[model samples]
Target: MAPIFSLFLVLITEFSLATAQQRNSNISLGSSLSPASSNSFWSSGSGQFAFGFYPNGDGFSIGIWYATIAPKTVIWTAKRDDPPFHRDSKLLLGNDGRLILQQGEDPEKTIAGGSQIGSSASMLDTGNFVLYNSRSEIIWQSFDAPTDTLLPGQKLRQFEEPNELFSSVSKDDHSTGKFRILMQEDGYLAQYPADSPNLVEYGYWDSGIKIAGNNVTLNLDDNGQLYLLNNSDNMKNLYDGGNVSDKLMYRMTLDADGIFKVYSYGLNRSDDDWKVEWSPNSVHKCDPKGVCGQNQYCILMNQEALDNVVWFNDPYSILSNTSRPDCEDECLKDYDCEVVLHKDDQCMKQRLPLKFGRQQNDPVITLVKVGGREFKKEKQSKVLIASVVVLIVAFTVLAISGVLIYKYRVKGYKKLLNSGNEELIEDVILRSFTYGELEQATNGFAEELGKGATGTVFKGLISNGKRVVAVKRLETVVAEGEREFRNEMKVIGRTHHKNLVKLLGYCNDRTNRLLVYEFISNGSLADVLFKSETKPRWEERVRIAVNVARGILYLHEECETQIIHRDIKPQNILLDERHCAKIADFGLSKLMNLNQTRTNTGVRGTRGYVAPEWHMNLPVTVKADVFSFGILFLEIICCRRSLDPDLAEAEVILVDWVFDCFDSHELDKLVQDEKVDKSKLERMVRLGIWCIQDDPSLRPSMKKVVLMLEGTVDIPTPPSPSSFLSSI
Candidate 1:
């Protein structure tokens, strides 16, 4: 009878404990609950969330999650690192107010703990799980640490702090895998080291502005206004373009694939689907790690170049040959240098000659302070010399006034003739062609030999039946202007240099302007140098480069007004049937005095081939034209474009690489294109390298380039060019 009574007492004690655990909604110290209890853990707000034992793939944990959904989603977990030991898990509120997770109905398997009694857990409406201790003090909170998503009031920390990263999705999973966010020193957001620092990526605002903060509340509206909230009191408007009212709630997350996107949620959708409202880093690859590549820029991808340059002017780089409206057109065509590592390492501009009519550098000014006594002393000496010269000049002027008028008219006529008015007098050297005659002779734009960035060249036969002519229709708006047109005929018609393409006649009918020249059956120097077959031997290439240089030298020194062809490239150098080279394309050419250091105004020329000084919009000199000729000299020796994809791995820009080769003794390697003769290859390579030194002062003059090619004078040892290549 006593044994039965003992059994009943044991059963009652166990039942009483279970009932107390189930009824204890008001959590206090020393309280305990079993996983089987109906109301073991209560959340702070509406029963939308509850904290209790939850089972994952193989183990169980104490987590807080939304209970309203059909399939509950765990928002925050307590024992993430240490899961329950076995099937039996119990939740206990200890005397210190810390929540403990114990396993298997045994006291030995307690794995993890939480906050003190009065501050164990609270679920905010924003979906944050905060843990507080006694006296309503918060100890640990889920808001401070995030997993995959950002809530409404929470912040997506900036990327500045070192080693601040996000934790992985799981111990076995290395993804989302410790994603980090902190305010960067550059005041921007960057993701680093998925595997290594060399493999990191960066992101910024559409305006190219960097973001800096500990936390950010990215608020989006149906209208596309994005607000980044630093905290409850501090906030900044980030963007505004989308329709925000479309959804009740939105989420912004940084995915494992280095993709940052924003998604919208609504009241109607039970499970919110992520919509990629913005992808900040999608097109950021293939360029220098933090920079956009070459002509490739980080415009809004939707904004115009003129509009975007104002916001992000520093990274705004324009490659050669790129026009304004089509800023990214060429960049989009090539995807080679898309993902780059260093911003400064990305190639921007290359070596090219300064164009004619550019503004020259400012003159150096010397400022000195003059005392009152010094100024008075200098003034007395100037007055004495001025008085004697004035009396002598006055007597001579009285005798020569009548004679001076007669001579002035004669001098004016000579000036007009030099200005090229001689074309009006057909009896003079100048010749003219009618518009109808040229069009018919050319067969209405017959077989075009080639086209340039500016104009087209067509092969034509003259009506005389004995001579063949190549007709060029200068494709410039002012090509047929009465003044310039006459000037071209007068200057070119008078010159008779064998190295120059002969100007037979010109047709100017306002709209129809054409230039007829002695036919060169062999097209352009570019075609032969870059000839499809590559049959031109090194000696022949050397011969052609020298001939072109001689032609330009004649124009600069021998011609009446040093004619600078402003645009000098291989195509501008035409080849005759005899393979003799003649310089062509003088529409953008400039005529200036021999003594001038530079010509100012009017920008014109091809990119990559234009000199670096030209970018400053400085006045040009004959040396500028010489610079272009030098580039042409190099181009002829090496059969490749200035910018070639084949050499991208080496980052070998034509000019810089040539200079580099000169330093490394590997210059001979550039001549390996099967067509070059190994015997003369070394000489030709040396000649080419000498022509493309980065410093303009270091490059040989055209006459010298011609002389060196012919072995007339010993070529001097060029400067190391270490500094010049560094600028690129």
Candidate 2:
């Protein structure tokens, strides 16, 4: 009798505790949670949804997820790209009505409701985590700031600041992925690659509805019906799962593979039971614009010809061929050929990085050149046999010639020891060329390449016309030119990087000061980015930007003595034959000792690309170079000059215009017709804004800049850059 009484009391207490938690679903102010704590999340009244820390990677991410599901499905994540926090991190609804994330000893970061005050928060059954005011008016909600998934009853309003949903990285990793769905202002619901431009041509899928009003919206009703609504009260149903029961759950998601899908599950069913209710018209996975990576092709599973596959029309060469097989054979023989399109006895060969590829069921026969892996294996076996035979013969010869080799090595060592220091220096380091030699190589400096503030560059040939070089001759050989000539020689001679132009030799005979560099086949970045009729591809531009950043990083941190390339504009960035960017013109570079970090210097950079500190009479550091690189980064993104007078009044200054667009959530204006990755563009834009901050301390280090550009680190929202300019 006593044991039964004790068990009854225990059951009653447990039931009471559960009832209390359900009733108090509206979390009171000052409530806090932690991943390490047993009560890590706040559950909805029905215990179906929860809001708090969830295990992600090796750490925890704050998000709202389906609590009852076996594998909890994350619907919304806070700071998706930010690194996950450790167990010590706390998510607290502060007494001051702000939701703050406290990660150990780091600065307290506000998750939401920074500006508005809240009285309480609630994890609603509808999957919304909302903050309420004193009168219980909703201040902010997770539904308003979505990440990846959309629940029933959520509305993706058109013309809103952020009417888009980025897919998760994967089912296990909830970080922002490589695809997005946008409810555009032009009354079209479109899907594009995360990094591609927001132009119509770049979109892989879109709703065919085109209306001329801003009242368009994408809605998901509680009945599992997905649709579009306009001001006329007209509804275009995308998917109708008529009258779903309350026990059923549904979600519309932009999948990681660039597919928009609708999924449904029964509350009583097993956790893994999820049925696809709707998906875009039986489209092949290869129909998307960016499904395949660069220099790769998408093939149908059945070996059937793609319905309507189209590649970028920019063919390097077009030839008349008799048959399709002949065209394929021709492309396979040509190493430069990446793709070949055969139609009506015409063979069109395209280079690598086939762009704008999609399925359209066209009549053309497309053949992609793939590597012969089996053939390589066979060739490798033959080479292995040859190498073994060569090694045996070489070993036999070496064993017989050992005495002779020893004598020759001893004689060479004696000669090296007897050589003069001057001779050794000339042999190991830079070669000192005579003025007459440089004149002969340059053909009397007749073919000029370009002219700059300090020197004129001429195309030249050395080593009997086998090696091409660019010889730069100092202009006046007076005060500035003399300083520049010596500066360039001293700075560039010691630095060696793949992205830095190589210095082969120098000539400083009397008044003739010249420096010879490896000739780059492609023109300056400025010419390719802005002056050319056809802009370089977006991927190429991104690679070029990273190349330049790495080169700058090497100069600022990796060198024996730190150097700042004061002028980091597009004009000073040269492209090699492979379109690799190389930093040129070290004339304005300033060297710093290992111990020194800052130096007082006058302004030495181009007008549009100069750092603000240069004009403030402040001592400059490596951050000055970072600032210049920032301006150059923006130019590379938009393929426009920093300062253009022939543009609109508000858009004259590139920085001012870019900040305005970013602030207004109109970054689409920057790359109007260009195809780019939207996520990368935003990341780069944020990084660029940070780099150009007025305060040097506000800018990230060159190493951090490289990481940010390469998508390794998350970029935070940058403060307005126009404040300092306005004050000025």
**What Cα-based lDDT does every candidate model obtain?**
0.51, 0.74
What's the CA error at residue 591 for candidate 1, in Å?
Answer: 1.9
Tell me each candidate's TM-score: 0.40, 0.51
Model 2 RMSD vs true structure: 23.1
Q: State which candidate has the highest TM-score.
A: 2
Q: lDDT of candidate 1?
A: 0.51
Compared with the true structure, model 1 gives a TM-score of 0.40
Give the Cα error of residue 257 in candidate 1, in Å: 86
**Model 1 weakest 10-residue run by lDDT:** 374-383
Tens-digit lDDT track of model 2 for 492-571:
67677778887777988877878888798888999998889878656667789999999999998886567888889988
